[model samples]
Target: MTSKVYANAVAALFDLRDGISLMSGGFGLCGIPENSIQEIRRQGIKNIHAISNNIGNSGRGLAWLLKQKQISAATCSYVGGNPDLEEQMLAGEVQVTLVPQGTFSERIRAAGMGIRGFYTPAGYGTLVAEGKEERVFDVPCILELPLGADFAIIKAERGDRFGNLWFKETARNFSPLMAMAARVTIVEVEQLVELGEIEPENVHVPGVFVQRIYQGVDYENAIEIPMYAEQ
Candidate 1:
């Protein structure tokens, strides 16, 4: 078969349509596919349903897209730092679903594992349980369904032409799970290596899950909340 590598993020995402469901891998600004997100901006695609740990802060990372009104709905754990996201939410311009950190992780995992839905007590008595089926095992547990997407755009520290990827430190947060949970997974890596450069054991995501891979440029790992000394 031919290689899975693409020339650029634009080519990798050529078939992407508006109103598509998407999963972007990251926690805050770490491990975000900034190049791909920029390409999304350049392409001017709108009305996206986004799933991630957070949508980034201010005018960077996913917040850049959110600021452009590209995102229609977001399902994520944290939305504190991005003022644009909060403003949109308050104005009823965007639909937002706040999931617990652990519940968010499990829902993505359940999709990848082909499970329909699982019960958890995380939000049993709160607003999360409203209208959802509940069963009493030891305590009341609400059914949390799986989440999937049409495409998953992820960033990696390094990868091979065959699509195997490896991420660094905290950057590895949601990339692997997003890779597994999407219909087409596209990865943007800092370094694109030969087929055997990355050993079998070191590979976080196998090529089978990733349909396309590309070398990204100018990665700005911006901190969402920068802490500075008092002046």
Candidate 2:
């Protein structure tokens, strides 16, 4: 059997270059591939277009890219916790495409499914409709295009040598869809198990969608919004 494991995040992201579109699988900091994001930072690759649920929180996660000036454009639903990202967007330094949360998810899903576009009423009559195609079915709808990436960086709780992955809790949010939507999918896992260790039914993303896999390091599960237990 061919092994999909890499020595490190740098090696796994060997084919990465400047000015490429990337899909980052995470909802805030929850399921992010922290190692690969750090590798991208260390390599100083610039002019990236990142697609994700959010631009990260504070100075961690994807915010590191924004801080490094590596990301030129961002396609995401939220950026409230990332001051650097908000600053860049407001300063016209980075191009921002803010899609409604549900619509954004569906757009990425459409790419993986090989669908050209779909109609949604999420942005029917607002600024989102300014220069896009619009039609009415039962209600007004806007044509949303599919969102694909050159590569996808995802995180899983467990992965096998051949690339099958299993995510934990809400960490499963955007990963499986992004895995299928990208041309190349790289996964960072906490545990690397032998092949067939994971049962067939529990595999979140099949090995077919993943090109490379590596065990991650120095994971910091940063809480975006901190709420202590009534202390």
Candidate 3:
């Protein structure tokens, strides 16, 4: 096969469908594919369902897309910073499914592993348990379902042209897992190097999971951090 396109990295991210599910990797504005999210916003794609740790703070990360009314539903663990999201939820403009932090991570991991599904005790008798199959194994558990996406937008600290990726610190959380679960994974990295530059052992995501990779430029360093801290 020929090499993939490299220019205009954001072009790799536009799905444009009304009901496509998207997995975005980030945690409270950390490790987010800001460039891809901005492109999605600029593309004006509607009715996107996002699976992520948080909705991202206002004007940053996925919040940029949420601000544009591009997201229709969110399966997230936390969404405290965006009032628009809260208002939308109250008015039924958006659907929100809150997942526990641990359960959320496991869902993405399970999808990556191709294990079909697994069980967990995270939501046993709450609303999360409603309408879901229940089974008692060695321990009390609810049958957790697999989670994958039509597309996954991930940010890496560094990536090789061949698509091997490395993430920094806590930023590594969901990016690698989401990379595997999506039909098409687009990775935006702060630094892009030629193949063989990154050590094989340090690669968090293999090229097989990533269909598109690009070098993003001019990422705003001050992303949604507290005002008390200097930018």
Give the TM-score of each candidate. Answer: 0.95, 0.96, 0.92
Query: Model 2 over residues 1-231: C-alpha lDDT tens digits?
Result: 667899889889998999999999998899899999999999989999999988777788889999989999999989887899999999999999999989888988899999999999998899887788999999999999999999999999999988899999999999999999999999999998988889999998889888899999889877778788975
The TM-score ranking, best first, is: 2, 1, 3
Candidate number of the best lDDT: 2
Q: Which lDDT tens digits does candidate 1 get at residues 1-231?
A: 877889998889999889999999988887899999999988889999999888766667888888889999999988887788899999999899999988898898889889999999999889878989999899889999999899999999999988899899999998898899999999999999988888999998888888999999988887766799999
Report the lDDT of model 1 for residue 4.
88
TM-score of 2: 0.96
Error (Å) of candidate 2 at residue 162 is 2.2
The C-alpha RMSD in Å for every predicted model, in order, reads 2.0, 1.3, 2.4
